[model samples]
Target: MTQLIFINLPVADLNRSIAFYEAVGATKNPMFSDDTAACMVLSDVIHVMLLTHDKWRTFTDRAIPDAHASAQMLLCLSRDSRDAVDAVVAQAGAAGGTADPNKPQDYGFMYGRSYADPDGHIWETMWMDPAAVAAGPEAFAAHELTPV
Candidate 1:
């Protein structure tokens, strides 16, 4: 069986967050969306549940931290190539998301960039060379793969 990940986030504005996710490539699954919350499908295996503060409290009693001021976590998605990573960050910027909220990373075999949604949730887009990935993590450390 394939396992799916659902990242539930508490948002200040449900509709606005939904729009931001849609602009960043997630499609709203109307089957799981309504006034209190919306399910955004980033990929077959990745889903994001955007919940209003009132709705969020039903599941957890913890205080919802201001994502803009502090980060509890950073969500990330993989891209096929380095250019693809850049493209998503560009799309995010154009869609009102703050682009490159975190420093971009480049390690020859791997590259990444990040953006923050309106609610200040940071999302990173990353890409790694297939060969490097297949060789495993130790491979990069053992061999110098600096960019030309």
Candidate 2:
């Protein structure tokens, strides 16, 4: 069987978080959803579980970090094209999320933008030309070395 990935996140407000994810294009999977948690399907292989604080606590003993104050992780999704990346970020912005708290990144062959959900969890949308990526390490060497 193919391995699937499930990214679980702690949310302060369940309904609001579900609405925000739905706005960003994820559909809720009722089989894995309930009052305290929601399973948002990003793709066939990728699912995001939005859990309320109480539900989240059941999974781990560690304290949940305040996403607004510190980034626990940056969830990234790839798009078919640069425009798609921009569009998703725009959608996120219109859905009561913050667009590009960090500057949008453009590396000629690749581009990306980010958004912060209502709970301050960061999500980044990116696009890269496969041909450019296949051109090898030299294509990104310069950008990697430059201090952003």
**How do the predictions measure up, each by TM-score?**
0.93, 0.93
- What is candidate 2's lDDT per residue for 22-103, written digit by digit as tens? 9989999999999999999999999999999999999999999999889978988999999899898998999988999777
* Residue-wise C-alpha lDDT for candidate 1, range 1-148, written one tens digit per residue: 8999999999998988988889889999999999999999998999999999999999999999999999999888899999999988998888888999998988778898899998899999999889988988786887565533
* CA lDDT of each prediction against the hidden true structure: 0.91, 0.91
lDDT of 1: 0.91
The Cα RMSD in angstroms, rounded to one decimal, for candidate 1 relative to the true structure is 2.3
Give candidate 1's error at residue 42 in angstroms: 0.8
